[model samples]
Target: MTFNLLLSLSIALTLVAAAPGPGVIMTVTRTLQFGLTAGLLVVAGIVAMDLVVLMATLAGLNLLTLANQPGLLTLLMVIASLVLIVLGIQSWRRPIILRLDEGHASVSHFMAGIAVSLTNPVLFYLAFLPVFIDLDALTLHDQIVLLALISGVLTLVLGAYALLAAKLKTWLFEQHPERQLWLNRISATVLFILAITLIHSTIS
Candidate 1:
């Protein structure tokens, strides 16, 4: 990837990371139910699993390229765009529900974290990352660099959330319950706009 493209993808990934989604909610819930240590472990697990997903996505994309499946790329772009749009709209309309108390009653925080991160739609969205990067053209070294950058950024963002949840548990869960919803809507709007831009580019 070009330096500029890598930078852009990094920014996009960071923005996605900042969004208040299932993974973030789970991270905060684990902090409240367990402790800061557990929460950080959860965050660690999340990052590790996401990296695995990213690798799988890259391998699958490479195989598609080897098979000369250009249509699959276009189809993925459309599907991903629609998914983002739908998710954004749903988030915008959904009511906020603070359910920290509803977290897993008996499970290892780290294990739960890995499970959530792996199943998280946002992480799976990495499958469509080729919409931004030329996956087929990327050398193994280039892929490693991009993956490392993504993992680093994801760790930073999720770690910040874990720290905040650990430090301000009561304030976040009690005093500012609605903040999560507000952040979710904002993130959703951004995703919607991004999807629209992608669609427009595809059509053009």
Candidate 2:
């Protein structure tokens, strides 16, 4: 709704996307196995899934807002904070078990991307974002802007991973477990920060 909100969203998404996860690993792996093209396909698949998740979240939030229930905003904010906090803690605690034994039986990298996105445990994290943005007040134009922003962020983040994978074929990142742990810590911090920011926004 505001430039500041849009800018914050962009920055937040960039950090989130950069955080090491199944999606990023898949992108890098595909890039190494196939090429940048395969990685791009995976990014596209992830973005498609992102669209689905955002739409579903918006619709569900709209339903709640339309009901004119009292204290709904506060309740949603609490739910959002709790969800983010849980995700942050889980991210910090989750163990990295790289499954590189893929058979590559998929018909196309594009489809594989969709499959990974669909199975992404972090997918529904998108649902908790309504606390940060006023989903019920978004206009059609705002929706388009949001979509474009998200698409751009996804492309930029995943595309950077693809390019990096292409350039550093010898460095697949799996070789360094420490780096993954750092990524997890950074992601967890960001999630916690987001939860705090949401609560602050609602309260003040």
Candidate 3:
């Protein structure tokens, strides 16, 4: 049962990671602007926050279930949708400027990553985590293992996105400056689509 639960959770996390969200956008932005190193730093910050949230959820902040808090999930969906739309618009309007300087901004990149992830309620739904398995049925050891596996899977998924963006930075953007702007527009469009989807889900 424990193994089954782990597998289920891993699949769910993979799907979630693949979905366009703040963390993915942050990773793409950092990679496009700074390079692979900065992108990795942003991913580290995101994963750190995700672990913190998971720990909180395991510690009984199972707010994701919305069992106790009426309308909380809907509220989160609405807020997240609005935020995504704003982010998308902002990205669409921002000029594509590449800053590969290595002197500073690493800390800011990391913190921005964390802040983006934490603010995205769509990513770490407190109710979503507990839906895969019965937390009460699991022993403390089981819970720890589940969380650890989740963290690992999350890192791999987000890391893949970072690497892909970094590769594109050199392969496409370096050769053609306009490519970055197009990429930014594409990312922004994805964000808008995600926001629309969330809103529809909330209403439906």
Q: All candidates' TM-scores?
A: 0.59, 0.58, 0.67
- lDDT, candidate 2, equals 0.65
lDDT tens digits by residue: candidate 1, 21-131? 756875765565445776777787778777766776777645334224446545655665675566567557756556644333333556656645533443354455867
Q: Give the lowest summed-lDDT range of ten residues in model 1.
A: 61-70
lDDT of 1 at 115: 49
Badly placed stretches (over 4 Å) of model 3 are 62-105, 122-125, 178-204
lDDT of 2 at 64: 36
202, model 1: CA deviation in Å?
30
After superposition on all C-alphas, the RMSD of every candidate to the true structure, in Å, is 9.0, 10.1, 4.8
Pick by lDDT: 1 or 3, better one: 3
- How many clashing residue pairs appear in each of the predictions shown? 0, 0, 3
Residue lDDT tens for model 3, 1-204: 566767777888899888887678778876775677878888887788778767766677655455234586567556666766776786688685554333244675576566566456633545586577776676788877877887788789889998898777776765577776777787678667767776765665
Question: What is the TM-score of candidate 2?
Answer: 0.58
Predicted structure with the largest lDDT when compared to the true one: 3
Score candidate 1 by lDDT. 0.66
- lDDT (10s digit) by residue, model 2, range 1-204: 889988888998898889886568767766655557777887887788677667666555453342244475456556656756775686578565354232243335565455445434332544545646877788889988887888899889999998897676435435754554565666567657756766665564
